[model samples]
Target: MTRRTWPLRAWTLVALAGVLLLSACGEGRQSVLNPSGRDALLLYDLARVMFVGALVLWLLVGGLFVYVTRINPREMSRRLAEGLIVGGGVLFPVVLLGGLLVYSLPLMQAPREADEGLRVHITAEQWWWRVEYELPDGGRVTSANELRLPVGARTGLVLNAHRVIHAFWVPALGGKADMIPGRETYLSLLPEAAGTYRGQCAEFCGASHALMAFETVAMAPADFEAWLAAEAQDAAAPQGEDATRGAQVFAREGCGGCHTVRGTQAVGQVGPDLTHVGSRLSLGAGILGVEAPDFASWIAHTETLKPEVAMPSYDHLPPDDLTALAAYLGGLE
Candidate 1:
């Protein structure tokens, strides 16, 4: 080989080695192949097989093109034409149907059982998710924008949409499931690891669709039970005159029209159920952190944070009224 060819070949080998190294190092719970749930893993396997098969077919077609055009261009006549026509006509339909069947058969088979699994109903709005869980004794725990699941246990999800169409997808645990308005869709997720996983609304709902996000907290069994019980209990009223004044403002003002807190007179269901608001990690549909200043800004002027939102801005209220409402709402844990 030429001296220059030796260097070029060495660089190509190095580049290929780097790519292999990167592929080897790519490992995570959210990875398509290293899935945390059973159905997700099965789907991953099907996609992988189809991907590899398609790549091989593409390589074969490329080689065929090169051979037909270069080495056999003079001899490519009636026989070659017939071979190309027959091969082209027969290959695509068979490959596509085979791939479709291989990918869809698992979904068509007998559904996986989740007899003892926890059941949660998830409703997706334009840019947020409202999650409700039913306990064993017929009681329930409702939260917004966050989902808590028990690690190593099968969890069944009943999904729907309140306003527009949206898709629920938590890459760590499963695939995308559509939440259609007025119809219920079911999916099962078994989280084997304990961590906060990011989830997003996969469908284009509205302007804030890019910001439509949620978090899945996979806790230990004991911790999950404790959280469930805590969420199910009635919300405690805040103590002291300042807190009392805040509560009065929360009730007197129109904030009670959309939000809810158990044991309080605010039982509106049009928005999130904030029974344990203070204990939650974030607020404003996970757009704002749970903090004093963030709460103040959001409650004062929600329209600024989300343009054209259904909820109106309370910026017209008096400064004291805004402060009192913020304090009271922030204390509902």
Candidate 2:
């Protein structure tokens, strides 16, 4: 092929490869492309259209550049050149961008009405999320790390920051909203399907910002109601001797000063609530699975897993005691 043709071909191939790579990147549970909510789907559609339009514009500009540089300039007319400059450079962008704005502005306002939706409050901390659900009767349920929504229902999230600025983003559910300290912001999500999605802190906050993630579970309306009811209740008593011993160990080690477990003396609010810890899909802000070994590791060497976390390491505890503690936390469901 000629050199001129080669450049176009190479550019095309690179653009195609980039698009494919981006498409592959969206297969994760937290992908905007794999949208599960009304707002997210709308945003995805807008993005795809904008991307295609941009690609076409890029090719047109590139082709014009190649034609001008590689061909005889004397063969071009002044009228054609001026038309290309004005139409392509000015009119095209104006029309395209103006149309896009008009199309997307309505979508930005299309989330379900918040007054009729389930109200949830999300407080962003340095590396974790504090979640609270407000019932229709004005009662509230508190949870940490995991957000559960009912499928086919509109949920309103009130965002606030306890320590630093953060952004609450569940890519599959909807667009992100910022969490500013002393300021309450809002976002609305309407889950259209029943499945599990992942969410994360879209804004950097601290040393473990990348690890500040959570799980979003969308369930049937009835199931969600039952789950909410269960969450509202205090944690059940430990059933086994190991768990009982572990609870004793937790209390003796001053773990209560940081974490909270309902129906127990551990009511400190310095860390995530552990009321239904065993039922959560992940632990330590989605860093690890809810397993005994992982729990033990987190307790023993928190700094090793998440550097500069507020929780101190419990590595000095006896091995058996650590095991018991892990077992106890694991059974918190």
Candidate 3:
């Protein structure tokens, strides 16, 4: 009735549960532990080393406490106490941390852009991204809230912020880079596999900072080239009577003043390039889906969905007109 201890199997089950919980946290595209690139792999390796060292230190100190309190219940000799305090407390951590610092210095070096390789210029807006690809042939193609890259290639990203400072981070790909106004920073990622990942603005900039995210898609080189070619084209004409009516609404409502649809006289550059918004994987900078309902919701609830957003709500429009407008935007693909 004095004390109780868990059975070995019970302890084992608890440990297993803890491991499963930790693994679940690292299972998604936004996790650094689920590394798909060279730089992320380096970071994962460093994390493993540090975790193991901390575990070992905890075990050593706990073991010494258990021995002194439960087993012997006696004071240690002066020499043993001094040695334990000096060696285990001082020498071990210094050597381990010094080695870690030496190992991480090279990994922290500035990214180098290889001549003739891929280069992308990214500008961080209040709650979105402006992505421009500098093609090898000296042409520029623009997109928004989505980044595409080729597998097994080192892509150089030139980054800057529009107003406040933001941080560009794709945890599965690499570390964070600060985006300062009027100053260009750089980050390089060498993707080792073809997959979709999530990137976010790591620094706190404004009210919608947490909602500011994007998608990173890594594809085969051929597929990436084909996609780029398609993205370079202007938007297709709106189809059907409802879509046509919606296009008229788009014009009459003066949506063209802020957005550029790239083909039919909607060339304004104050906001994201919606040249192919209908075909994008997501909307509202990865916060909404690409379906018609999603489009309507974003248009109708701009501030409610994304606080302090620059785009005004179009809720005043009639429901039929809204549906038509959504359909027209969807057909831009």
The model with the greatest lDDT is: 2
In order, the Cα lDDT scores of the candidates are 0.77, 0.89, 0.88
Estimate the lDDT of model 2.
0.89
Backbone clashes, candidate 3? 0
Better of 1 and 2 by lDDT: 2
Q: How well is each residue in 38-87 modelled by candidate 1, as lDDT tens digits?
A: 65666667677766777667556755665566544566578868878677
Q: Pick by TM-score: which candidate is best?
A: 2
TM-score of each: 0.83, 0.93, 0.88
Measured by TM-score, how close is model 1 to the native structure?
A: 0.83
Which ranges in model 1 have alpha carbons more than 4 Å from their true place? 1-34, 88-100, 107-116, 239-242, 318-321
Candidate 2 C-alpha RMSD relative to the actual structure = 2.0
Q: What CA RMSD would you report for each candidate?
A: 4.6, 2.0, 3.0
Could you tell me which 10 consecutive residues in candidate 1 have the lowest summed lDDT?
A: 106-115
Candidate 2 or 1, higher TM-score: 2
**lDDT digits (tens) for residues 159-265 of candidate 3:** 99998999999999889899999999888888888999999999999999999999999999999999999999998888899899999999999999999988778
Candidate 2 Cα errors over 4 Å, as ranges:
1-4, 75-80
